[model samples]
Every structure is written in C-alpha cells, then in structure tokens.
Target: MSYNKGWRYIAFLSGFVGLLGVTLYPIAISPMIDASEYKKIQKEARKNIRQEDIQPGNMKVWSDPFGRKKPDSE
Candidate 1:
C-alpha cells in the first residue's frame, strides 16, 4: 500500500508540473516570437514602401452621389 501511494504521489506531481509548464510556456515565449516577427514585417514594409504611395497628392477626391444632378424624369 505504501509503495502504491508513493507511485501515485509521483504520478500526480509529474502531471501537475507538466500542465503548469504547458500553460506557462506560451506566456514566456510568445512575446519574444511575436516581437521578432513584428520587427521583420515592419522592416519588409519599410523596404517595399514608395514615397509616392504616402503622398496625399495621389489621392482622388471623393464625389458625393447626393450632390450629382439627377437625370430629368420623363
């Protein structure tokens, strides 16, 4: 009975530790992984961006449909 109890306690402790590691692993590692990826994306975006793309002069003015003259109703 003592041997069985000891094994049971070891098994329970192992399972608890495993679950705690699994829960904390992502919390510890995700920010580091995400920060690196975010930096990589920022660099790529900056490299691919063109000066004209950011200029407001290239933008078209929005036309309002309500401001247009309606065709003469027959």
Candidate 2:
C-alpha cells in the first residue's frame, strides 16, 4: 500500500522525537551517590596488587637468520 505525504511526515517527526529522547536521556538524568560510597567504589576500582603474583608470559627470542650479510669468498 502506498503512503501519502502526511503519513510520511508523521513517521519522520516521530522518529526524530524518539532519537532526541534517546540521545538526551543520559545527559538529562544522572544518578547521585554518597561521597563515601563513591570513595569506596573508587578505592576498590583502584586496588593494587604486586606484579610478581602473576606468572610470566611467553618470552620470545627471534633471531634474524636472513638479516646478516654473508662473508665474502676469498
């Protein structure tokens, strides 16, 4: 079925409004938290551990076999 200009205009306007709402929701409404709670979260997020606790990763030693020039023949 073919839609006339009015239906198309309405659909476009509705889509634009929906897009605006989705984009503005996060900016318009943000949650407020206690300073102590925020600090606890920050401290937990920044917790540090000794580097030695983790096992060593793969140690690759690549020797360039073709990079060296050959000695000149006497």
Candidate 3:
C-alpha cells in the first residue's frame, strides 16, 4: 500500500507540473521567444502596404443587400 501511494503521489506531482508548464508557456515563455521574430515579420509585412491601399476613398461603408434605398440627403 505504501509503494502504491508513493507512485500515485509521484504521478500526481508530475501531472501537476506538466499542466502548469503547458498553461504558462503560451502566456509567458512564448512571448519571450517569439517577440522579436514577430516584430520583424510584422515590419516586413507593413513595408509592402501603402497608405493608398488602406484608404476607403469613394467606397461605400455599408450597403443593404435587401434593396433598401437610403435617403439621398444621407
């Protein structure tokens, strides 16, 4: 009985540690590891984008597909 209890305790502790590591990795470790790489990739992506491409000039913000006509004054 004592041997079994000891093994059970070991298993429980191992599982608890594993769960803690998994839960904390994304919240803590991943940011530290990927922060620089992520910023570099974002910068490269932004370099290809232009202000004209992001502008919404002459484009309707929203349109009703149900054929509802908006007032001309609006």
Best by TM-score: 3
Q: Output the better candidate (2/3) by lDDT.
A: 3
Summarize candidate 3's per-residue lDDT along 10-70 as a digit string, tens digits: 9988999999999999999998987987898889989978756576976555567698876
Error of 2 at 70 (Å): 96
TM-score to true structure, per model? 0.39, 0.35, 0.44
Model 2 TM-score? 0.35
Worst 10 residues of 3 by lDDT: 53-62
The TM-score that candidate 3 achieves is: 0.44
| Worst window of 10 by summed lDDT in candidate 1 | 57-66
Report the CA-based lDDT of candidate 1 relative to the real structure.
0.79
Misplaced by over 4 Å in model 1 are 1-4, 30-35, 38-74
lDDT of 1 by residue, 1-74 (tens): 44547779899889999999899878886766678877888898899777566868776445575788778999
